[model samples]
Target: MINTILVTDDNVLDNAIIRNYLYKERYNIVSALNGREALELLESRNIDLILLDMVMPVMDGYEFMKVFSKTPFYKEIPIIVTSSLDGVENIEKILEYDVFDYIIKPLDHINRLILVNKIKTAVKHRNLISDLNKATKIIDTLSTTKNI
Candidate 1:
């Protein structure tokens, strides 16, 4: 079960909006004003997913993704990027970081639903993949023993 979600956006209003929406869904919402703050939270929290905003002060989304991906602790945490920028180049840049989904700013009713569902799906997929990896390791160990 996904227990924690980290919301990283420089905009204070945006953080409030995201918190309001996600709080209703009973998720433990952790808010950060910038990527630097978000990184600190990740070091201390078990965040299951991240809602990342593209533009920010101190550290932007792109830079954050670059740094975050290099670490094994929270590298696989699913990220759904929230951006006001809409362009092919911007999207391509985000895609390079392996984000699970990209949501444009000013999320409406439909977009909210979609975002919620996407978070649920991403968490589920991560859990499934973890289980598969553990099973594979067990199988490999058993096979080695059988050959002995």
Candidate 2:
């Protein structure tokens, strides 16, 4: 279960819209105006996934990804890019970070549902990978113990 979600966007209205759609689902929602604030929140909170916007003041999404990817906690949380920018260069830059998925802005009803589905899938995928890593660690430990 994805218990906590971070919504990072410079647009206040856009953040509100996302909150409205997700409120019924009852997940703990955390908001940040930009990547710098998001990073501050992540330092103290447990975030299952992030709904990130590409354009923002202070720190953009690409800068966030670069910093996030270097952290030890990167693998535990998944990020879904929800941005208004459609430029080819923007997409290519975001792709380099290997985000869970990229979602364009102006989400209609169908697109909203699609976004929710994608979030669910990404959360499940992150959890599965985490579990696999734990199992691999256990196996490695056992192998080392047997050798000793």
lDDT per residue (tens digit) for residues 1-148 in model 2: 6478899999998898887777767777999999999999999898888999989999999899889999987667889999988899988988888888989997778878888888778777877887899999999999999999
| Candidate 2 minimal-lDDT segment of 10 residues | 19-28
Judge candidate 2 against the unseen true structure and give its global Cα lDDT, from 0 to 1.
0.88
lDDT against the true structure, per candidate, is: 0.88, 0.88
Q: Estimate each model's TM-score.
A: 0.87, 0.88
The reply for model 1, stretches above 4 Å from the true place, is 137-148
The TM-score of candidate 1 is: 0.87
Candidate 1 lDDT at 136 equals 96
